[model samples]
Target: MPVGFWVFPWDIEDEGIDRFAARLDELGVTSASPSVLYHSGRALLPRAREHKVRLLGGPGANYPFESLETPLAGMESASAPGTGKRFWQGLAEARSDRGIRLNAWAMPMHGSELGRRLSVAVVRNCFGNPYSYALCPSHPQARRFAESLVGELARSRIFHAIQLESVGYLGYRHFHHHEAEYVGHGPLEELFLSLCFCDACMAGARREGISVVELRESISRDLERRWRDDVWSVGVEDVREALAANDDLQAFISYRQATVASLVSSLAELCHSESTELHCFSAIFPPTLEHSTWIEGTDFAAWSRVLDRLIVFGYTAGGPGAAKVDEGWTRSELEYAGRYFDPSRVNVVLNLAPQYLATLDDARRRFRTISEMGFNDLSITNYGMTSETRLDWVPELGRVLDAPASST
Candidate 1:
């Protein structure tokens, strides 16, 4: 199996490139996914050298290159504080020295400053409340900005592959700073409330022959009733019933899927044109859990058509304090995703922190299971959170990964 590590710029700077590369070599890691266009922080190190430095807060691009002028003007771009070495340049040097593949980790639509600056371009719910965490995919300016950013990353020719995150719609709930208390909301209700009724979204729904006016009114009335009752009904069937009852709602969901698919397709074409591969971090929809696509507008089947690889975050085991471990959850999620994506191209990401895995023995068990399933690609959650104690498990995992496929 080809093992990869997800690293932050802070990790590289805190631990010099030589030390970082040495650690990766020790762990048998073959690739590194470093965050480049990160959210709300820029690398402050002069060069990508060893130093203990914290990332400064604020929304801006951290790439070494200047922001390409686009139709949407005034996009912010910030270079690293010291040596002003672009992030890609630093990673390129490490790649050359360590002989490791470099994959650029990018967050496309989760720009806090951009969303707040252009509130109209942010995602608005049925109640006309804007979510500052997400830029509405249907917004023309937001779409153009995302497309332009992806094009720039692909054209850079520094990354072996661009791993895209947050490329779809965000729902009503977010882990924002100083989040307020909004109780009595069910998951299904949250999904309903998260439906975007912005002008662009409404226009798309309208074009799909959905009666946006009627759908908005219906959703508003339903939400009011749920809020007054202070009760939420669970299960996917409840969502199915609601959609089945409302033709316009069903049409709108379909429209959202098509819109997201089109955007990804366009970006994938651009990546292919540059001879760069495009991959996306996708949420695994367990059969028992709420289907995330309902609110996020991610159609895995559609995305598989354009994406080169589908990286599923299949962390079946819970963190340190988890009530119980469900060993079957990971396999189930992977199998479910296998229906839509090629098993060979599906990279399963495992949680490496003690909070997620109880012990090295537990980690070994998970690795054996993945190998038994014939998965050839695996990745750790991140390098920043891998504690000194957990670091010991890396080489052990490498041993299991090197073993031949199990017949079981």
Candidate 2:
């Protein structure tokens, strides 16, 4: 298997590029996917070198690109201040010296700064409340920002591939710190709440022959009823039933898928033109058309035509007892992805945290399972957050993953 380590700019800066590259080499890592465009956050220590918390911004950007020179109207630049080593330059140097492939990891639409500043461009719930953390992908300005960002990254020419994250509409639920909102929200409710009915999205739906007005009213009525605790058990099946019954709802869903596909296709073109391959990191699992389309606006079939590879999160560590369940989930995801994209290009990212995997044995088992599934590419969730002891598993896991396939 081709093993890649997911790293952050600060991780490289603190450890020093040479040392970091050497360590990865020792661990038998074949590639490095470093974050180039990322959201605001601080890295936890013990696992990370002593470094100050990064107050949410793209830290690696130093040189001015014409695409990002002029700020989008009503939005602030989320680029972190260039105070120390330039990320792209350092990464390029390390790649040259260490001979490891670099894949630029970027988050296109998940900038909280842009969403907070341009509330109108953010995703809105059925109650017309804006999620000021996720930029609505259908927003014209948001799409332009994403395209320009991708173009600039491709032009940088430092990456073997560009991995995009959060390139679709974000749902209501998130892993935000200190989140305390408890509204008895179920999966179906979260799905309903995630649907963006912003002006751009509504207009797009209308263009796709959807009755936006009727759709909006229907959603509003359902939300109102749910808010009052009047509905009993709203689940994925309920959402499916609604889609089956309502033409407008179905059209709106189709429009969402098309919106995301169009953006990805445009980015793919820019990347290809610049001689950079495009990859996507999506949370939409099982790779089913309906689940991917309705939940996250991802169309795997459409993406397969453009993306060089697709990496899906297979962190299935609910607890020690959930190993079998995790394996089943991971298998299903890889199997589904193989239906659209080649198995060689479908990578599964595993979580190495103790909470996700209790022991090294568990990690070894999971790694072997992924290899047995015929996936040639494997990645770990993160390097910055993994402990020193846990880091030891990389080389061992690499050995297991790199082993030749067994004869039946």
Candidate 3:
């Protein structure tokens, strides 16, 4: 398994490129995924020589782009992707000297700056309220903008591959800063709330002769009634049952998946034309990890046909809702993934922090398990968020990954 790290620009800039690349070498890392575009957040960088805390927002052109021509004009990059000329210069050196394959990572169709643009409708709920964090890919302008970003990243000539994140429909859980939703919406409720009812979605449904108007009304009424109910509990079993029962709802979901798949195909075609590899982090934002990428309109079968590699966060692995993460969890997830994607085309990332792996033994055991499976590529969560102690886990895991058992 070829290993890589999902890194931020700040990580390179703050740590200096030589030191950064050296860390990768020490960790036996062969590839690097650096963010070209990222969401707004304040990150406490542990190893930074300069400022420890960095605030990131907006698009950037650290690598020689002509102009700031996208939807984000005045919004200059606060945590600029590559810190001016020094970053590119250092990155070029790293590539030439280390043979590191650089993956230009970008978050598409999930930016508030792009979503709130005048021409974009963003994603809307059944109640028709806009989700500012999401730019509906079904929107013409948004689709074109996504094409523009991918095209530019592909054409940049600096990357061997381009990784796309949040490339589909985002829902109620795609939260903005300081978010507080007092009302508790269950997993099923959140999924319904996340469903887009924007003009583009409506049009797509209408084209299929779906009674969208009545469907929306039915959804709104049901959600309202549920909120007013004193006791409402929906477990994982309720999700598939509900979808099976509601034909119109199922129709809308199918349309969303088709629309997203179309967008992914076009982007993949664009990347191929530019002679760049395309990989997408196809996992949906959770509360519904059981459905994987399905909940957010990403049809894995459709994606399997197009994407050069589909990256999934196997963060939760078990039965429905990941209710029990037993020893067979990873094997079960791989089997489930085989239904949609070839195991060879999958890149599974392990969140090496305390949040997921939790211990050195757990990390080592999981690494050996996946490596012995021998088909999927493995990527560590990141260089930026991980502490030095956690990063120490990579060298051992990396060695285990390269063993004969994983060479099949």
Higher TM-score: candidate 1 or 3? 3
Give each model's whole-structure lDDT. 0.73, 0.74, 0.75
Error of 1 at 46 (Å): 22
Ranking by lDDT: 3, 2, 1
Question: Model 2, range 52-162, lDDT digits (tens) per residue?
Answer: 444554322422345663454323224332443365677688887878898888776776666655667888877788887778889988888788878877888878888
Candidate 1 similarity to native, TM-score: 0.89
lDDT of 3 by residue, 1-408 (tens): 588898887788777788888888888888898877766667776767776777665543334444335555444366774356557656967866987788888877776666655345588889988888788878887787678778877876678888988788887777788888666567678777888888988988999988999998988888888888744446776677778988988888889889999999999999999899899877544325454456788888898899999887656643343322623556666666767777788888777766567677777677777766655488876788888888888888877777767352
lDDT of 3: 0.75
Give the poorly placed runs of model 2, Cα more than 4 Å off: 52-66, 72-87, 175-177, 230-235, 284-293, 320-322, 405-408
State how far residue 204 of model 3 sits from its true place (Å).
1.4
Per-candidate TM-score against the hidden true structure: 0.89, 0.90, 0.91
Give candidate 1's whole-model lDDT.
0.73
Worst 10 residues of 1 by lDDT: 283-292
Question: Model 1, 41: alpha-carbon shift in Å?
Answer: 8.7
Clash totals in order: 4, 1, 0
